[model samples]
Target: MQNTIFITGASTGLGKAAAKLFQSKGWQVIATMRNPEKENELNKLENVVVLPLDVSDSVQIDQIVKNVTNKYSVDVVLNNAGYGLIGALEALTDEQISRQLQTNLMGVIRISKAFTPHFREKRKGLFLNITSTFGLIGFPTCSVYSATKFAVDGFSESLASELAQFGIEVKVIAPGGMQTDFAVRSMEVGSHEAYEKLTAEVSKGYSPEKLANYTKVEDVAKIVYEAATDNKKQLRYVAGSDAIALYDERLKLGAEAQVANIKSMFTF
Candidate 1:
């Protein structure tokens, strides 16, 4: 039987690419976003249903779960509905911080909780989270965003261990950067004048600006397919060539050296 996958944030970016890729592969896709009206293109695809789901809204999440369960036995749940809130920690407001956590961290928690019962009953499922390379290493001007991703990383790690015996796998994808509207729409900048220098430094490291950056939406989609379809799942998949290379470099450098190198790169 073709597996069914439910993806959050399917309106654009990697989610959009994954939806198209999976649909081409003949899998049933329940592509959800904040607005159903905005999904005309995705809805026109075969075996793809564009549902209304605002991951930050609990009511919407519960309703989508019920609708999905009634219509299909979803085999994989991709928690990809998140945005970046870039700012110095001191300049960030409580509301801004809360919004970041709500959409990135708590949203994942809510979706996972709603689907856990279904996975438990079937005893087979996968939860894939789209994190970032920043989750592994912190950087300036993206501290809050990194914090949320760190939460995702820790959550996926702990949940993977907890759900292993139950046949549920939790995996995280840490992509360095990609050519997507994520940089244009998903990033939140702060009002700290002191952050100007830091912001410039951060901009240089953006995945889109990097030379021959290997993190593409389709590339991440393929990795998502592997995580969903492969019997032996990996805990995390780095989705960018630069990320993989940098990860290796970090590993070789010892902890102290890695920290020093990162600090020098960011001038932090």
Candidate 2:
């Protein structure tokens, strides 16, 4: 029998890539996006079902999970729906803050909660959460975004212990910058004149040379597949060379020294 994976934010980028990869691997893919009508490719693939989901909406989340679980035995759930909220915190609006928190943090929590009963009853399942390198190490412009990812990281870590008794595995996929439209389409920048120098210094880190080394969406998707099927007790899979290097540096330097190291990169 073939297994099924339910993915959120599957219309584009890493989510879309993962859906395709899993489908190619002979697994059924339930690809959920905010607008399934706008999706053109995944809908046409065999063993792939495009469903509508706005992870921020609790009602939609519960209903969709119920409908999918009833019809298909979902073996994995991928929480890949989130966007970046960059720039100065002071420049960010209350609406932006709320949206980031709702979609990035709460969305993951709610989705995990919705599927907990099913996984618990079946006594086996996997949850692959798409966090970020920012989730592991703090950055200048990613305060809010980092907070959300960090919370998810911690949440997954704690939840893993509790769910292990039921054979439910919670894993976090933390990737660095990827060659995606994330910067162009999936990010919201809050600009404020007072913080121009800080944001500018931060912007310099995204040099062309650095971006050229960013990992491909498909590559990260492969890592997701590995984490899903590796059947190891590993709780975190850091994808992308940049992500691995940075995280390794953090681990080697220790927290305070790592913060100072990152701080030394920018002068504002």
- Cα lDDT of all candidates, in order? 0.86, 0.94
lDDT of 1 at 265: 75
After superposing candidate 1, which stretches have Cα over 4 Å from the reference? 207-214
Cα lDDT of model 1 by residue, 1-268, tens digit: 8889999999998999999999999999999998789667999998998888989999989987988998799999999999988878888899999999999999999999999889988998999998988888777777888888999999999999988888988999888777787877788867678777777766775555573454677887898888777776679888778778777877888667887887887665
What's the distance in Å from true for residue 255, model 2? 1.1
Model 2 TM: 0.98
Evaluated against the true structure, the overall lDDT of model 1 is: 0.86
Instruction: State how far residue 241 of model 2 sits from its true place (Å).
Output: 0.8
Q: Which run of 10 residues does model 2 get worst, by summed lDDT?
A: 203-212
* Candidate maximizing TM-score: 2
